[model samples]
Target: MNLSLCMIVKNEAATLHKCLSSVANVVDEMVILDTGSSDRTPEIAKSYGAKVHHFRWNNNFSTARNEALKYVKGNWVLVLDADETLTPEIVPQIYSVIQREEYLLINLLRQEVGAEQSPYSLVSRLFRRHPEIQFSRPYHALIDDSVATILAKEPKWQIGYLQGVAILHKGYQKSAIAQGNKYAKAQAAMEQFLAAHPYDAYVCSKLGALYVTTGKINEGIELLKRGVRTSEENYEILYELHYHLGIAYSRLQNPKQASLHYQAAIKLPIYPILKLGAYNNIGNLLKEAGDLKTARKAYEAALKIDDNFAAGHYNLGMTLKAMGLFTDAIACYQKAIKLNPRYAEAYQNLGVVQLKVGNHQASLIAFKNAIALHQEQNPEEAQRLRQGLQEMGLL
Candidate 1:
């Protein structure tokens, strides 16, 4: 059972070596399609024994990926990117996976690495070489339709999930986006895709997300709403549309509409992290609306899903403090601190709650700890803490 590694890259010279080196010893063959790189990327890949081929950029990921498929010599294909590296610990198990006859495709968990907030997403990148199994969707190219087509033709075809196999992706970070013209290119590609696929709910949702990220709140809200109405059958897109719509409305200061969309997102069978975000944001909006009881319930709902979620604990603490429940608020804050020792905001809030309960010494200590943590990283916040301490006659 031979596994061929396929990748399409352009101007990824900086991190290409790390990516290629990570999987060079594992795969049977490496086939890289370079989309006009003006760097040493091709040479670096070739140095690692990759059969590098030059391809013209067409603003379509599926196009390049399909072209690369023609060069794969192995029976099984593992599609990856120049910014991603497979986990070294699971490299040995990949060979056995390629030999499995029951499944037509295998799904791996791709985890974002070196980002402030890393999230894991299931992606179908490993599969048997078949002419019918190709990539689709312009901006965020996917093989869902192709996979469905293959499975329809072969009734016994199955998709298996590899639990331990994972890839670390660094290309999706803000710093990486700013390093190249990638964001601009992606925005343009999304707009182009939307023009051709006007009624495509998935494209609309993706474009709407890009608009939100680029700060076009009104436009994002309109597109997201369209996506929601057009994508009733697509639960994935509907979840995203409602979640992003809630965020856009929150930005517009329309808490009522925001809460409605957030609640809608929460009801969807989406990822737990996304559901947690919806619950937390809904709690924030309700708290701002002076609905302390409901806000507390929302926070509790978030915590029930993950008790170690420090943000949920901190948010509940804030709501409790606003309701004049100082002791309970302090307890929540302490739990947040226990979950995350470096939570400066949690410590600051704890100090405030402690001061309210007439524990000046403990309050001063908490404030000092908070100040020490934020002094260099957040000078403004540290100064504000100092002023708070002076007012309390503790400094």
Candidate 2:
């Protein structure tokens, strides 16, 4: 089956090349629809031998995505964003799935690069080229709603998901978020959709989560509670609803409520990789509540899901340190630092642990590394560390 890479972009020149290059071998053609770009995004798209088209910006992601889909001339369509790339490891799996006759759509697991809270997400980005399968919603647009309708009418069509990570997405990174007033744009787009779909669980999960992260706690809580009541057995939606609620309640200083929500999210029948956030958060709650043993178990569960999770390693190190297991704590902290070299907190904790174990030289080096990393990110903390070093006569 021929696969077409379909994308809607604007001013995405900085990341477009990488995105196109990642799928160059797997896709037969690239179709890019630019929605009013002021940058050289179209030029970059064309450089990759993509058929680039232009569309007016209407502040609706679904409309733009639908327009892009119209240009696909392949048996299958693989949708991606400018900052997202197909993982080379999953290319063969994607090819295998697309050749299957029963599949109407395939959901791909995406790893959110640089995200500490929720590192994985499921995206319904691969599908057969059918006229009836169009996207919906103004933001976070997807064809899932239409897929549901089609599957109901045509029982022969089946939807499936790849269990392993298929895409590496960098759009959620802090640098990307700061560039385009992205928070404002997402809020405006999602809020527009919410006006028409006030009770939509998808919208509730999305916009409510946004509101919670952006300081509108009460509004987000109200919306997410509504989502929990109205969601139609969508484990994905339910998981997100509870996950964001946990964050919201944690911010409100209600650890009991937060733990409950996080556990609820973890208990849902979702992929284990997707449950990392809830596991980490509940572990944090347990640690703060003086339940170090239970917290260690929670962190261990997260690490079992993805051993490379730096936060899990660092948190596990903390739990171990509190339990007076200095040797094990040092190993966990070192593992975390190895995974993320610039992890300032991990370095700081490693310094403290090294000092506890009487490794004076290593302790000083770790403290210096931590201070240097914190200099720009947290100057006040850096100054405090400097003072501690001076008092210890190690400066």
Candidate 3:
């Protein structure tokens, strides 16, 4: 049950220590392969007692990752990123699975953190270190290709998804400039890879996402739409494609098309965040269309699926408030606050509802809370709140 921690890192000085510290005690050995880091990344890895290897910056992620794999002497390897860390719960789960000889591949859930976070099921953060499990492609490298081959031919190796471990991904932290640069490099590599493998739907879909992130809206939408058309059977890509299309259309103010795509997105087995987002968007569109009842229904449906869904609650409250259902709206806003106490939009909505219902003192408190939260996240929003309060003579 020897577990080796394998990682690929670059200029990750800020987050490298936290990532290493999270899983330092869990693995038998730590192997870090640096792709020409110019920062204190390698030094941090060494400080954490990780055996560091410097590799030339190759555009292909799989190549560097496979090279890191070569240094892993343990029976099982846990692949991680410099921006990711394993949770304490996942450590014991990997150990338990490694104690058994039946399982060859185990998939863990990767939860991306921060304000705009989402979760996805990912494989091979933990798996057997067999020579047959070679990674593939440039970006978003996967070991599943070889594992699938083994499963197809041998039919003896066990493949299962483990709920015990979750990878906390912090790649999208507040450092927008650094994150954008990483994406720029990835986009360049992906473009070169796509030139050789043009029909790769996964790569195309990722490229679309990158374009959308970089504000190339029309190009991103077109790429995503093409990806969906080519891989119609691939529900996963279709889900993402439809979701992003809705986003692009919404930005264009084409509510009709946005609603259609949003509806299509929810039909696929995507993550909860996507599902909730679709629901929220649909509700918003319906509200804008003057279909208040349907909007309420959509929001309620989202809440039924995930009670702690803060956006759903906030949107529902907004809809209810617009319809003059002040008490019900307040309840929804309160529920949103319970789920996410730091939700500034919910507090603002709650304040507005309270003011409408003549609860000036409670409204003032809610407005102040909203202002405090918004000041940290968005000063412009805080200014708007202050303006509203001043207009009401509450400031």
Candidate 4:
């Protein structure tokens, strides 16, 4: 089957080449829709022999996506954003799955690069090139609605997902959001769409989470609760709704409600990899409540799903340390540092644990590494650590 890589980009010259390079050998063709790029994004696309089409920016993702779809000549289409790339491990799986006739759409699991908590999510990036398949929603443009319509008309077509992570997306990282006014852009687009689609589960989930993060806890809670009450049983949406509700309640200092929402989120039958955040958050709540044993179990469950999750390892370490298991805490902290070398908090805690165990040399080294990392990521943390160490005659 001929596979086409379809994408909508604007001023993405910095990342377009890397994104395209990852899939160029795997995809039969590349179709890039440039949304008025001032940079060399179009030139970069053409360098890879990609058919580049210009679309005037209208702040509507679905329209741009549909325009890009019009040019896909292959039997299957793989959608990706500029900040995302196909993993080398998934290329063989993609080739294998696209040849199967029973699958109409395949949701690829994506690893959120640099995200500590919920490191994995499923995205409908790969699908058959059906004429009826058009993206919907203005912000998080999705073809799920169109795909659902097609499936209802043709019941034989089945939606399936890859078991392993197929893509790595950096767009959801805090650094990305902090740059490019991305948070503002996302909020404006979703808010506009939510005005019309007041009951849309996807938008409500996305916007509610945004609101909670932006300190509009009450607004976010209202929308998320509305989403749960009105939206159909989309497990992914439901999981996000409850997860964000947990966050909102946690921010409001209501651990009882937070734990309840987190537990509800975890009970959803979505992929365990996608529920890492819920597990981690619930563990944090449990830890704060002095339920160290339960918190340890929660972190263990998260680690069971994704052993490479550094945050899970770090949280487990914290719980172990709180339970006076210093040796195990040190091991868990070391594992977290191995998985994510820049994990400053892990280093900081490791230092504390090492100091507790009378390993003065190791503790000093850990503190130095933690201080260096915190200097770049959190200056206030670095300052506090310096002051504490100085008071203790260690710095």
Candidate 5:
């Protein structure tokens, strides 16, 4: 089956080449709709043999998406973004999956990068190109309903999940945020969506999450609660709602409530990354409450899932140090540094522990390394480390 790779972009020159090069040979056709890019984006697209069409900036994602869809000539359309990449390993799998006419739509795992542990979710991006199969919503647009409509008409049409296939999403990287006001634009779009869909669980969840991102804690809590209430059979939404509620409660300094919600989210059969986060957070809360034993157990549980988690090891080290287990704490800190060499806080804490045990030379080396890593990233910590060295007469 010939696949058409469709995308809408504007001023995406920095990421356009990476995205196009990843799937250039995989797709049969490339339909790129440029929404007024003053950069070399259109030229770059043309260089890649993409059918680049100019589109006006309409403040609507779905509008641009639908316009791009009109130029797709292939039977199968694979929607992607400028910051998204289709891995080489998944190319043949995507081809094979779409070749089968049994499924009208395929949901691929979209892995969000730029985090210590990347989280993934099943997203609908591959589908048959039918005239009625158009995108909806102004922003955070989707065609799930269109696919559902097609499935309703043709009852035999199935939705397939391609295993071991993922789309690497780099849209959430810091560079993207620094270059644009995507968060603010998305927040406004969510508000527009929520105005009509007052009880929509998904939109409520999205808006709540946006509010949390923008530091509107109370509003986030209220909307997340509404999302939880309205979310009927979606365990995924429930898990997210509970998880965010746990975070909001933590921010509010209500550790007991935070722990309760974290436990609630942990009880659900969700993603392991989320479960690991819950365990790690629960440990932090327990540690804050002066329960070193329980906190140790929580960190142990997190390590059980992912033993190589650097933060988990560093946090466990802190708990051990608090409990006066210097040897164990040192081991944990060493393991954390082994996993993540750039962990400045782990180095700083290791120095503190070494200083406590009267290992002046080792403490001095660790503090110096921490200062080197922290100088630009954390000036306050760098100053404190310098002061510590001066006090020890090692400066």
Candidate 6:
């Protein structure tokens, strides 16, 4: 049941400690392969008793990950990123699974937080140590290689997906500028790699996401649509492409097309975020179309999946307000504010509902609160609040 935790990192001092600490007691050995870090990442890994190995940056993730795999001597190896951590519930599951010899690879669900969705999905992170299990694909490296061909001959070899544990990915917290730099480097590498392998669907899909993040909406949409057309049966790439396409179409104010892509995204089995986000977006689009009853149903469906989602409550309130259901709208806004007190839009909408119901005094108070919250982040919204107050002669 011995286990080894392996990772490759660079300039990750800020999150390395948190990542390593989360699994320090769960594994028998920790191996960290650092790629020319200028920060104290190596020192921090050493402090956590991790066997640190230094490797020069080769602009290839597969090479680095394969090198890290060479240092793993345990029966089971768990690959993790410095920005990711094993949840407390997953540790017991890993130990239980490793005790049995039936599985060669165990894929756990990865939960990417701070995004607009459920965040949880499946990925292969844990594997039985075998000489044949090598990594391939330069940028977003994967373990499926010629090893799969060899393993297919072994009648006892089996790969199973585990639902007991999930890896929390926190890599998206970097500032926009910092993220832009990382994406730039990744884009360069991916472009060079694609020159030699132009039909790589995964790299094409990843490049599309990078373009979207960098504000190249048209290029992103084109690349994503191309990837979708080429990789029709590839659910992961199709789901991501459709999701990004939906976002791009929404930005272009083509809600009908956006709704179509969103519906396509939700049909994929692997898209948790797409599932919830599609419902929310469809709700908003329906509200904009003046379909209050359908919009309310969509919001309710989103709330049923995630009760604490403030956006769902806020949108539900807006839909109720559009139907002239003032009291119900106020209740929805109150719930939204309870979930997220700093939600200025909820306060503003609440004020609008109050004014419609002829509660000028309460409307003034809500507008004031909205203005106070909006002052620092959004001056235009603050001005709107002030205008509302002025129209009521309360300013």
Q: Residue-wise lDDT of candidate 3 within 309-381, one digit each (tens)?
A: 6777888888888898999999999998998799898998898889889999999999999999999989999
Tens-digit per-residue lDDT, 1-395, candidate 1: 88899999988889989988888888899999999999999999999999999899988998999999999999999999988999987776677777778888887877654332213456779888887889887667877778978888898889886755378788777778788666687888888878878877888887887787789988988888888889967665787788788888888889989899988888877555436667888999999999999999999998887686688899999999999999999999999999778889999999989988999889988999899888966989999889877886789
Superior by lDDT: candidate 2 or candidate 6: 2
RMSD of 3: 2.9
lDDT of 3: 0.81
Return the TM-score for each candidate structure.
Answer: 0.77, 0.98, 0.87, 0.98, 0.86, 0.82
Query: How would you encode candidate 6's per-residue C-alpha lDDT over 1-395 as one tens digit per residue?
Result: 78999999999998899999999999899999999999999999999999999999898998999999999989999999988899998777788888888888887877665555434556678999988888877776778554466577886877777654468887654563376477777788877877787666667787877787778889888888878878757686677778778878877889999889978887787635436667788888888888889989988988887676788899999998888899999999999999878889999899889988989889888888899999976999799779867886888
Q: By how many angstroms RMSD does model 1 differ from the true structure?
A: 4.3
With a 3 Å backbone cut-off (N, CA, C), the pairs that clash in candidate 3 are 90-165
Give lDDT tens digits, candidate 2, residues 70-90.
999999999999999998989
Candidate 2: regions farther than 4 A off = none
Model 5: lDDT equals 0.85
lDDT of 6: 0.82
Flag regions of model 5 displaced more than 4 Å.
Answer: 116-118, 162-165, 271-274, 300-310, 323-341, 353-366
Shift in Å, residue 211, candidate 5: 1.3
Candidate 5, residues 1-395, lDDT tens digits: the string is: 78999999999999999999998899999999999999999999999999999899889899999999999999999999998999788877887888797888887877666543324556789998887899988877888868868878889888887765469887776667656888889988889878988998878877897787779999999999999999987776787788788888988999989999889888987546547767888899999999999999999998987787788999999999999999899899989999878889899889989988999888878888899989967888899879877886888
Tens-place lDDT digits, model 4, residues 357-384: 9999999999999999999999999999
Which model is ahead, 1 or 5, in terms of lDDT? 5
Whole-model lDDT values for every prediction: 0.84, 0.94, 0.81, 0.93, 0.85, 0.82
lDDT at 61 for candidate 4?
Answer: 93
